[model samples]
Target: MALMITDECINCDVCEPECPNGAISQGDETYVIDPALCTECVGHYETSQCVEVCPVDCIVKDPSHDESEDDLRAKFERIAGN
Candidate 1:
């Protein structure tokens, strides 16, 4: 599944640069993760780099954009142009 930055985000600015897909960005209030670009780092790393670096632990799986591992892998391929 794609990940989401909740309102709990502390705006620590740590997660933005960690996203391999460049999905995370500064929103009006908090960081936002674009579901269209988010692959949860499936093809780039073993774990979600943004989540690993998040100081507030506000990033979580987006239930609204739920996807399987295969789906995430597919997204990664599309993003990577593989």
Candidate 2:
């Protein structure tokens, strides 16, 4: 599944640069995660780099954008053109 940034985000700016897919960005009020571009770092890393580095632990699976492992990998490949 894709990940999302919660309201708990402190706008620390740590998570944005950690996202391999460039899915995280600063929003009007807080950091936001783009489900369309998110691949949970499946193809780039064993774990989500953004989540791994977020000090606030505000990143979580996007329930609304739930996806299987295969789906996530497909999304990664689609983004990577692999």
- Report lDDT (CA) for all predictions: 0.93, 0.92
Given candidate 1, what's the lDDT at residue 78? Answer: 91
Residue-wise C-alpha lDDT for candidate 2, range 1-82, written one tens digit per residue: 8999889999988989988899988899999999999999998899899989999899999999989999999998999999
Candidate 2: residue 37 Cα off by (Å): 0.7
Model 1 Cα lDDT, one tens digit per residue, 1-82: 9999999998998898888888999999999999999999999999999989987889999999989999999999998999
The candidate maximizing TM-score is: 1
Which prediction has the highest lDDT against the true structure?
1
Minimal lDDT window, size 10, model 2: 12-21
| Each candidate: RMSD | 0.6, 0.6
lDDT at position 72, candidate 2: 96
Instruction: Give the residue spans of candidate 1 off by over 4 A.
Output: none
TM-score of each: 0.97, 0.97
